[model samples]
Target: MKKQLLLLVLLFLGSIALLQSQVTGTVTDEDGTPLPGASVVKKGTRVGTTTDFDGKFSIDAIIGDRLTISYIGYQPKEVLINSTIMSITLVSGVQLAEVVITGSRNPNRTATESTVPIDVIDVKQLANAAPQVNLNQILNYVAPSFTSNTQTISDGTDHIDPASLRGLGPDQVLVLINGKRRHTSSLINVNGTFGRGSVGTDLNAIPTAAIQRIEVLRDGAAAQYGSDAIAGVINIILNKNVDELLINVT
Candidate 1:
């Protein structure tokens, strides 16, 4: 009885060896790009190994055993271990939730490359170099297309010293502070000033010390910025200096 039991145990072990073999394969995407660090495991068992940088793996398995493979950003796959060599391709999975882009300080896209005619003026440099004392006076000397005049006799409209651009009326040009519309006085007719029939803002109120730069768009933008910006657009950017003090001497 003991000899019969020993013979049966030996036959059972030999049959198990005949059914098993070594399997090898490569894992990749539809584009044939190797998927490094991919997971490869046998079904219903913890025995498994990960693919190398070349997306190749070797594992021991029996005939008809199931092999599961998976990777990050790719769909999972399963294959029957019928052949010694195999090729696996995984499809893409998941998607990016959101994406953002910013170009505020991109040096390649400077003012010179603008499609419209634009004049970028450094306020701090001009105030220190030029002899002009006010914003109106400084711009008058630098920009020939811009014009401004003091009013004394027309409906009390001299407070703002209305300005114009591109030989257009004073009300035609639009003024913006930090890209927002600056408030202006009510419409009124002028008799003794070049900016006659003006409804303009107070340019003198804005000190040069508080400004960083000025962007002058000398183009017809009525279709884009409404009728008020028909002649052009003047945008003022404020100073963003940190941990420093600025003193302007008159």
Candidate 2:
């Protein structure tokens, strides 16, 4: 009797595993053109895949699986799959509005509600502009008050000075990557004659292709981001949806 019971349990488990299915399909834009290198993720989970050159993709998931489809310059689409061979159509890209977070720690709050002034750069704008190499080239000249100085250094380290937010030193200005604080460069000094110094972000650490948007707050935010907030804050938001095997055709 014990041996028979064990066999029944094993068989039940095996059957359940087989019930889970795999889903696959090609992704395309509304114009019926193939969208290669598009991101296809299982909604809520990190499991995902990118479309190949032919805009073809395959992924493993069970029935009633929720999948998210996203591509740069295109609107994201989510679908619930109950069968095999699901073709997804993504819409034309929409221009996203500028979103800023100022007062308090709440992300839902906008710049209007806060005491500080936050500058928002939409991702669509950056993609359309097609910046080359470092993001510093663009961020420095684009914003009103911010200034970037590129100093050529020969000390074996890649030398690109940090950006100055309203002439404040680099150390005084806090830099956040993907909304998380990153370590400042230990090599250079951002402080100048002014109580604030000449510090800038090493844009090389971040790739323009991966950037989603950049937010610059032009007021004092010591209370929100802590001590480094003395000068101001620059937040670099990275895209979480891209899945391209980038091949730079030089």
Model 1 poorest 10 in a row by lDDT: 102-111
| TM-score (all chains, Cα) for each model | 0.52, 0.47
Candidate 1's residue-wise lDDT over 1-250, tens digit each? 9999999999988877757678899999999998889999999999899899999999988778999999998878888888878888989964668768754322322376777767778877887689998888878877666888766766666566778898888789898999999887675656666666667767878988888888888888889889999889989998887578888788
Q: lDDT per residue, candidate 2, 16-87, as tens digits? A: 775666788999998889999999999989999999998999998877889999999998899998787888
Error of 1 at 211 (Å): 0.5
> Which portions of model 2 miss their true places by more than 4 Å?
1-110, 130-133, 153-158, 190-201, 246-250
What lDDT would each prediction earn against the true structure? 0.82, 0.73
Model 1 quality (TM-score): 0.52
Clashing pairs in 1: none
Candidate 1: segments with Cα more than 4 A from true spot:
1-110, 242-245
Indicate the residue-level lDDT of 161 in model 1.
Answer: 77
Give per-residue lDDT, candidate 2, residue 50: 99
Clashes of 1: 0
In order, what is each prediction's RMSD in angstroms?
Answer: 14.8, 21.2
